[model samples]
Target: MPDSGGLQSVEASQRPDSQVRVFALPPRDNAAATTIVDGFLEALTSDDPSYAVARKYLTPKAAKDWHPERQTLVLEDGPRPHSTDRANAEETGRNFELTGTQVARLDDEQAFQPDDRRYKGDLHLSLVATGKGKPKQWRIDTPPHGVVLGKTDFQRIYQSVNKYYYAVDSAAGSGAAGAQKRLVADPVFVRKWADPLTETVKEVLAGPTRWLNRVVTTSFPLKAALRDGTRSLAPDDANKLTVPLNKSADSIGAAQCRKMAAQLLYSLRDLSSSSVDEVELERADGRLMCTLKEGAADALVAPRYSEGTEYQYFLDAKSRVVRMPASGGAHPSPEPVAGPMGEGERRMRSLAISRDQERAASVSGDGRALFVASMVTNASLGDAIAHSGAKAEKDGFTTPSWDGQGDVWVADRDPKNRRLLVFGQGQADRMQEVRVDELSDDARIEAVKMSADGARIALLVTENGRTRLEIGRVERDHGVTDGDVEISVADLRRAAPEMEEVTAVSWAGGSRLVVVGRESGGLQQIRYVQCDGSTPTGQALPGLTRVSEIAASDTDLPLLAHSDDGIVRLPAGAAWQAVVKVGTAPVYPG
Candidate 1:
């Protein structure tokens, strides 16, 4: 069998203060010389009790030469004293031992023995005197098994012991025999203790563990470098790639890894900030249409006449600019009339055309009839029989008036009776009167307006130095029906107690109504009221103060209002843009 034993020599020298030291050294070519010196010193310093006797072989003077190296072990010799019993016996001449016998005894003590326990002790190193200088050498006899003769014998013996203790084969075998045999005398042992007995097994188990450890250690440092400072973990080049690893594992390097990570992070941020909804507006013929703009649903048209201009006829049943052919002009016409005047002519002649421009004018749904009123003429009606032809009538005494559908409602005063008049095509002679008995003797009707449907009417009546709103239902052919239809008497007191007189009243879409009143301060407030008899809702129209006239829409929402200033549209829902300032009073429904 080949030798499996290995020898490691450690050279060390003592310090000036005398301390024993030890260190390892590289191997020498001569295996026996290396083993003898290494093994001898190792046994001398070992914790075994047998090493005590082994130390005596070294000479005190010779040991002084052993000095420790800067990075190696050192050995030193100490004083040796004779036994007291032996010294005393020699002085007493007891003749216990002769000089020759003592020499023989010392030689026998140094003899090699296979079984004698004394000679089979541990080895030690000491300096011995040679020809010129002291040489370092080891004093060793043999183990109880006897000294091995050659390299083969030494390996066999060592292998036998190694196989017995660590279960490894000698250096003579194949497979890991060479490596395993070298480890027999190595200072440290390396072995896998558990299930992963192979190198591949150990690597697999360690991969994730090593990776996790590297991540934990580097994560915080990498974040700090990138965030708080200008340092970057990635390379300057956009195409550069790098893999992250720690000291414990093999170096990792991959291309484009950092670039890919950055892209992924940016994508996540963009996704988080995205929004998902839709929005729109409604328009018609380049005009934005809204229900709240005009008081009515349809767009508003301007009144036909300008301020201070007097018109001859009222709106006909169709709301066109037409006149009443039956009533003749009160003033002598330039053209002579062929017909003779009757007794009724004198009564109707009192209804002269007022010099003041018609303060109020409204057309019927079909655009054939126009209702006109003024403080001077009291009332002058017109009808538009054709596009150009018009007829005027001076028939009754009325003030602020309105036309709805084919019927006309007006605020009028008679010498015998003061009331509201409802007139229509053939029923002009049969006009019905609405008497407000609740008003005081001094109170009088200032303005009146009929709803779009002709089913409701609003009256602005002044009573007892205060103006009050009287909303009532309209009876067929008859004037406004009476009821507890008063929308607001208290609001009238608060807004305008002295001049609580109503200036203008106009119907909005449906049962909604707007009543304009003048305050003592000359300020005007337009009160919005619901004819359905709910709480009277009011809003002040600042621009429409002292409103001398009013009108309503027939088809869409009612927004048309006429005043002394001009024809204006008070759109519904309080929209400012819905107000269309017209050049003339609007022809309703047309």
Candidate 2:
């Protein structure tokens, strides 16, 4: 076939039970330098478990020194091979420069570090003579360290997995052993088709990454590791997994041992086919220590809500708080909540329910006063816990969000008195002013949403008249007693970097957010973005118009949004259906 404007296509097919595999071809006889360089790059992105085929393209010394696991550089569009000026028809050795726009780097810890810079690396290939009548062959003598892959190829070759760790209760006295037993997810990338079982387990023993280490604690004992030279981990025919620890963990108690097993079970939950049903731990002497079954482990570390969300609340046309069963039928009847805000004594512009669903916080229609009241009883609206002096409603307090720790967070958008405030768990009398560590001088928060685990927070930050979404780590320092607790938001990173403007955002699931925004000069669209700023392919949902606010639960339930046509709900694999004729600010318990 003739060349057609440098365009080409390849068709792939496979059975439903099988997966698609990519292979790398070995170097051919009398191959040119370009072929050797290109073939080695292709092999780095293939399914070779140990990259054995890629090593065949290099010299013996280069092959022995190359380490593919050291790092992975991801480029915008795979590397481009350019023949250097040093290469000509006369030289036996040739040099080539691989160039591209580097987008990110996957370090040895399997953590993806985002980057944007130009990349240039040198590869030298030499021709070697054959012993017999065969022609000489070109081989890579000096190759770049580790591997380099394109964005698309990296996504295809690697997968995202979350390793569970217990959240550190800074409000409690001290030490992780006494902290709350809440599970926090630490995400990392591993090979999709490679020995993921062993790879993921190894990451667990290595402990959490630096960014998340301050807020989480792992069950793995110090210096605890897999037994000497142990590999090829897999469940037996009866769906039982046995893990043997090194000598450092031989003296651990039964309770700590079970916690270790629970961490392993949660880390491997995303594996295909749910192959593991039970986990057994063994000491260095091969003696059984503790065992945990799938059903039993659920009691120890379960989802956000064991029983599920009780109700979803929103504001009716009268600006009164109303509620319906969260898991109700397509159109469940909406009734006012049992509180003064629901009784129409005070009209609220927006509201947030605590994680326990026992208390509610409502902002007045003018957004100047924020009241906290009991949801279980018909209690009168209490005195304002927070007040914004800004006269304009748009410049007053934003919606409040509650974390699992019972703390309420809200931002005062008044340009003159901009501040982020937090109301402590039991201290309603004291409204603590929070200082965001790295926030810019001109930036102001438009909205705030906290994760259920109380480890991370999402903020719609506006700077220079453009609003963007950012994720920050919640750090708490309780000096000696609960009254001396200090909180600060640190390490802010863009969650949706490509969006030019973000209007509404919500935590859709663990480490995922449903964001409503638009690109530069583009129409508004709804998309799902990962906490690390990587947008998964095909994650965009059906388009909806005039979406003022959006809400999603941690569990995989229907998505509710307040759009121009009133409240709309999107069930799995279904279009946006009408939830009510008129409503606004639909939300589930955080």
Candidate 3:
């Protein structure tokens, strides 16, 4: 594709206007390079010298090729117009003389040489018409091999121009180059890498240790006065003097006295050349002694005696008696003697001494009291009952339960044998023990809880996946026999077949008992069953996970469920809400 300057105009036979023709020169051998360069140069019209139209046809490779150097096209004329007169032509030619001409002549004697393939040369041609009716048109056509297009040159031109425009647009569009210019304008940015140690040294020189010390000293009165105020004075004298600036009242008084004492002692020893020594002062009766140092005469040591002497005292080298002196007078008469006290008297005195020990443990309701089966010693149980001043019976057994009337029912947990012992309050030896082995395997009595009226007892037993709730009548002598204990075994799988294990069992209100079990899906379900050990009466309470323990509140309206996460208060008919969180083990009151 020819450049704008190289475009040729041809005379149109049909139209009055001339048509401009642009020829795309083919490369010698490379087809790709020829297309790229030709397409690019053809785009450089008079209207778009920036090659805006040429860029569309230019590939990325072609754009890269023409980026570096400036380019221009040189055009040659083919034919000259015919002249009518020879004289006029000669006169015109004489008037227009061409200079700076070099001529090369081919001699006949020299042999014609073949053109070298690598050598490039330019051809100059001129044509003139001399005697013709209509001057014949003379046209010079480019030879195929002599003036053919070069693919490398064409591609290089396109690529160079494209790159120039790309760079111009990139810088102008993003303002990245302008930002870089501004950044470089700062001297800090330019010298950041130079003399880094000097910058560190300057920073160290500007550190604030001195200023911080000044601030602290200016704000602390005691320290400032101690460091800068008067010295060698008494406390009373120092109090009369004006207080130092920024010093607190308490701190000023104390510091002034201390400073005065320290300075006086230092001056006496250093400036006055004085020394201190201790001495013993003896009294005339040789029964008492006193010791003191010279400067502290006002201070006294208690009188002491040696070898049954009457008086003795200690004095300093300055002849100052430092100890309390004995008086020259007779001693007073001794008081009347008393006999030694007996064990009974001592015991009476010992009643005044208080002992630190747990006095008693009591729960509000009798049902809860029975639920917390006591394994406590007989003395403590008796003490608990006696301290309440209620009728308490020890039953000659460690495990005790107080009936509403203060009668204690003690159960002995011996397998193959079950004994329910009954005793009156404070009567440890007088107890009636009843055997009820036929009712249960004594080891299976997992828990025991009395009813609210103390007339019935509910004993729970876990046997495999089945739990038994035995409701028994409280008897005076024939206690908890098979006939008295009404046993009902609840197959938990049938009741709550999805449960993996029962986590907790507690009695709620009336005959309602709560059995909390963990399901296979890692959720906890609390089922309410009657005392007769029947199927759960209501819908299983939902939305509990990992229930570790459960306790019924005293009011039986809220069930406290303990889990790894926290303690949740599950209302009787509502969902559970976290009430408290315990990171460690929890202690629940009965």
- TM-score for all models, in order of appearance: 0.28, 0.92, 0.26
Residue 570 lDDT, candidate 1, scale 0-100: 44
List candidate 2 segments past 4 Å from native.
Answer: 1-18, 87-92, 128-136, 173-180, 480-483
lDDT of 2 by residue, 322-394 (tens): 8877666777788988868678687788888888888888788899988888876658776888779998999
Candidate order by TM-score, decreasing, is 2, 1, 3
Q: Kindly report the root-mean-square deviation of model 2 from the true structure over all alpha carbons.
A: 4.0
User: lDDT per model, in order?
Assistant: 0.29, 0.83, 0.29
Model 2: which ten-residue window has the lowest total lDDT? Answer: 10-19
Choose 1 or 3, whichever is better by TM-score. 1
RMSD of each: 50.7, 4.0, 46.8
Worst 10 residues of 1 by lDDT: 97-106
lDDT of 3 at 91: 22
Q: How close to the true structure is residue 401 of candidate 2, measured as C-alpha lDDT?
A: 91
Model 3: lDDT equals 0.29
lDDT tens readout by residue for model 1, 1-590: 55788776966733221122222232223233335444434433322222332233233442333221111111112111122234443322111110110000101111111111111123223223333554443332222111112221111111100000011211122124112211100010011111111211112112212111211111011211111221212222342222222222222122122222222221121221212111011121222111111111011211211112322232222222322111123221112111111111111111112122223333333222323333232233333211101232321233334333333455443323455555442134535455443456666665555543333456666666665666543433212553112211111111122234666555544434555666566667565544422222124444653455554432234344455444344444543222223223332321
